[model samples]
Target: MKPLSIITLDQISDALDSIDLLGEMRSAFIAYSSGRSVIPPVGELIIDEQPPGEVHIKYGYVRGGAHYVVKIASGFPRNQELGLPPGNGMMILFDVSNGSISSILLDEGQLTDVRTAAAGALASSVLGVPGARVGIIGTGVQARLQAVHHASALDRDDLMVWGRNLGKCSLLASDLEAHGLKVEIAESAEELAERCRTIVTCTASHTPLLTRPMIQPGTHVTAVGSDTPDKQELDPRILGSADLVVVDSLSQGLVRGEVARSIDAGTITPGRVVELGQILDGSNPGRSDPNHCTVADLTGVAVQDLFIAEAVARSLV
Candidate 1:
């Protein structure tokens, strides 16, 4: 038997684009919520040289879907010294009925970034306000992916960005503008939030990066940071005021300190939250009114990783 071929981030990116991964991820999430998959525990700070590790594993087959995939990934903060990402991972794709390895995908930064951006795109398409003026609250790689995905999903051309470091934000704005987007750099997350109806936060902060007052009524926010327990990008008040707070997975977020802190503080109730998969399945309504606030808290999910792996495998065949 031939050994699984090792794949790189660039290959993953090409595969992701070719397979229309956003739609695939959306369908996979809905099936995941319907009890069709086994999602494992996610441990945060494992990679940070902290107390524990953040590990996630999941196995699932698309409903009326032909394939299954499982992914295991870990984020270790110490990798920075090697000029490498703290996160490194691989995925296994299998045949649906009889579980057999179809392909293996080896990716670190590329896999996570693509799937994360796809989730934001799915959320934007399903819940963002119509004709939204988008705002980005970071200029990192994930931020760039978020900008592209939002543009694809919303047909939006207007984007405003902000970063603590003005030079980085300015450079990012220029890059996006070159991509045919109307990009602007704002002074703060508050300013970006105030100017756009759809806001996406993709930062690596341990504290709140945005507040409630910055958000207008009818705004939709997708918080892509906070994959670890110690990181949070949105204020607790925003959680309390949201008409709907959608998360990629309930079990996953509770492990991360972001939602757990809010829940522990009594600022938000776990019962009031809905999974993005449930919303996609029509089990719960996504956005009931244009005048309401909605928040999608994403801590990342194994299901997404698996789905993307399957897509990449198929493209390779």
Candidate 2:
């Protein structure tokens, strides 16, 4: 039996610098939507204690791939108060041929964050206008990642951000400015929506923050905050009004995220949605008209974890 290798966060972070994360994420989505990967529904546990939190268990395998992956990640917003990062988790890799434990990646949620950011960037690049100023809603880790990723994707360094906490928004702006991005603090989400053609919402809000009336035509919105049924960032009507609606996983999107909310509200039909992979693979059109309103409801897919983990494991070897 081969020894199981355990990797740490530092090593994974270093390895990521050499990995083409955006390319890997793109391939992951294509594989998933093309029926080349075997991924089950996500399992989740919501903690309702004083500091609310949620844990997601995602696992899956790609056909004929070298390894399978099982990822466990958690998000506890109040952890920052205790001087700890809110995101934490690990990934377990197994030999595909023998079903034997191969490696354990103790990334502590960095992989999840990066893969998600990559997905958001890729979606925006495919569905959004080129060189459009980006707007981010949220002041947490994802907000920063999405800002930076979108900057790199669109080759634009100017961004507008809005959050409930002005202090946090200012802090995020400072961090992004250090990355060479021109940051503006929007007084409200409505203001942010009006200014930027490409907007990425990364909050954990249970209620809608971006309403239909706030969104303008020819805008592309990426909603990554709503991974659970009860969580929502965009009003259901936003999806109903969007000219193009995309999702990472159609099945998952139909049950969670903004798409689900719109469906439940009788605003949009499930058939109106298209998978992001379809756009990547040229099976579906993405924002053909500059005047079209587009929305991408990303719930996070397991194939992303599988591809990213496999890339990290191969890089380590």
Q: Name the top TM-score candidate.
A: 2
**Tens digit per residue, CA lDDT, model 1, 225-310:** 77766688888888888999989888876767457768866889888888999999999988999999999888777778777787
Scored by CA lDDT, what does every candidate get?
0.79, 0.93
Deviating ranges (above 4 Å) for candidate 1: 1-10, 43-45, 48-87, 94-100
Compute the lDDT for candidate 2.
0.93
Q: What's model 1's overall lDDT?
A: 0.79
- Per-residue lDDT tens digits of candidate 2, residues 73-189? 999988999999999999999998998999999999999999999999999999998878899999999999999999998888889999999999999999999989999999999
Clashes of each: 8, 0
lDDT of residue 178 for candidate 2: 90
CA RMSD for every model? 3.0, 1.0
TM-score of 1: 0.88
Which regions of candidate 2 deviate over 4 angstroms? none
